[model samples]
Target: MVSRRAFLRGLFGSFLAALAMLIGLPLSYKWRKRMSPTRHSMPETRSGAIPLPYPRIRGEMSLEEAIAYRRSIRDYLDEPITLEELAQVLWAAQGVTETRYGFRAAPSAGATYPLEVYVVVAPRGVVLPSHDFLEPGSYRYVPQSHSLLIVRQGDLQEPLYRAALEQEWVLNAPVNIVIAAVYERTTRRYGERGIRYVHMEVGHVGQNIYLQATALGLATVAVGAFVDEEVQRIIGAGPHVHPLYIMPLAKPLEPYRVSKEELIGYIESHRKERR
Candidate 1:
């Protein structure tokens, strides 16, 4: 039995969700698909260390070439990564497509963007893959052009590693992307039902990162073990930007691991109907 007031509230919530979706979905899609009218602007922050803006090189490798390079390296070589490689990886993860319709590296729910990317760049300055270790610090990703924005600069590895349930990989990876989810972006439209859509969108972004890393001859693995609040606090997202997944990436050895049978199984499951 439902009270009149509760019934009306439910009806109102549904109506509001439908109306918002009707209008917001297209706008969100256009927003994701379009590029910023202005050139890339790194968000202003006085963090002392200036984040280097690397020119992103696109279409450098064929899909097969990238697939061949896919791997997850816990141990990197004795050499640091080049700026160009970093830029390329970030761009592939979420770079703007055509300066219109903000089509980013990953898909979204109704174009109502809900994900924010951040980097935990090792070393306060540039992290060298070589012997001279760089300092440990946290950074936010500027998606407009995939630039790194320094957030908390210090030896956060211990805390971060602990937050991630003592996963040694957290301390070892050269760079980690903390993928945060802002639920309301979609919930405002689809209401509670939007929860499912938001989760799907996050997976899309994570896969985008994996594929891009694989393409760039880098190693990466998806992580979801860290304390959500701790990650959010470190990355400096509001209550809305809830952390969902963390992906740490590094350079790997040649020859990626692939399971053709597993891939086929996945393709078949969704071929008829996702349900």
Candidate 2:
């Protein structure tokens, strides 16, 4: 007879296997080349490794502290940052904490996990995963193992700037973190109505990054202005996945401030139950 712990472990493993099989492959790139104008564009794949250094880490913050501190910032200093700082930012945004369960720094719909993280880094501030500088390009971020896969090489600032509809914030920052999602990743499970889950997951990840930036003493601005097709192209994304938000990261220009009334109103609005 197996020990109780072993028996439970077996049961759980079997259950997950059965669940996966029953679900089938919910969403598998049917819209492979569906591009939209103005979306982020990128090359197909990277020929080399991306520079991802060991992340710099800090102790966890209390929920209150994280909330009280979180805010959106746009202005930054034209300063150089460390490879360690970049690592810490990515880890805080979506790095895997525990490999056993394949859990991520962000939540997903049904753990289908459709969100992809990418980065546009400058040379002065940080050295990346493999110390590979493909020269001003976008890269795919592998969070589970903390590595980057090159997608596109060469300066993409102009295209990204255009795709973002000439959002100066995208060009002003030292790095840009783009988050995209395969909508069907969640929708296929619960049907098209589940698209809400995809957006919800995006928001969760967005907030996670925001909190991390706050704690790290950095500035970040989330932008939603872009032609979806161009963005997908800038990142060299496949057809099914599409851009959702762009977060430009940099040093802070000034401290964040908010009035008590504004804070109260924000909380109250969020707290109200959906009709």
Candidate 3:
């Protein structure tokens, strides 16, 4: 029943199948290994997600002190801010304060949070305790995980500065925090009125950032003048996400200190001149 031609043909088919497996198996293994997620991967591994240190609830500065010292600072020294400081500021902006209900630090209208926070880091902008620096890039803050997801790699300071109407502070500061809104998150529930709520929520978040920065002896100024479309592109935001604010943060070149009385006196002087 087995002819010599038939046996030769069967042997040839088996050899080809073996050769194919030898070629394909290694490639398949390599792909799977590359695609697999390592949950405990370190930042140096470039896994694209960086876990932030836990935020401290009790800072040295009291709430009143932070409020009193809060001022819009424009000039900054060339220096890198610590990752811990960055973490606290991000937490203040929108980190989840309650796990069970997923409530954020900033109050959302009807618990429908529409705000997204992003940070654009300059070269040598943020440093770890070991003195290693975070790669200069745009990172989107994930509130639930208290982590940063890399959006784009490489220095974006110049582009962001140009986008912000060539503000020197944007270029000079070590980091810039950009706040964007996804209106649908709120608008779906409250309709057009939700737009107003979203604005209010952003204001709250901005104030939180200001206070937190002040408490940490950091300086920041809320920058509103910029081309919206350019900023959205620089942050790699989706079409639905619209930028609302850009805050440049760094150590002040000189600390500005003023008492309430001094502020009142200056105001009075200006009022007298106007009259």
Global CA lDDT computed for model 1: 0.63
Angstrom error at residue 52, model 2: 2.6
Per-residue lDDT value at 52 in model 1: 44
Error of 1 at 52 (Å): 5.8
| Best TM-score among the predictions, by candidate number | 3
How accurate locally is residue 49 in candidate 2, as Cα lDDT from 0 to 100?
Answer: 40
Residue 160 C-alpha lDDT in model 1? 69
RMSD of 1: 11.8
Model 3 lDDT per residue over 129-174, tens place: 6687876878888786788866666789999999999999999999
Error of 1 at 150 (Å): 2.4
Tens digits of per-residue lDDT, candidate 2, 140-216, equal 67775576655665567668888999987677776788999877656755687678888888898888888787777
Candidate 1 C-alpha error for residue 48, in Å: 9.5
lDDT of each: 0.63, 0.68, 0.84
True-structure RMSD, every candidate:
11.8, 9.6, 16.4
**Per-residue lDDT over 107-217 for candidate 1, one digit per residue giving the tens place of the 0 to 100 score:** 655566667777776652244334333344566566653455545555565676778997877767667778887787678767998899888987887777777777667
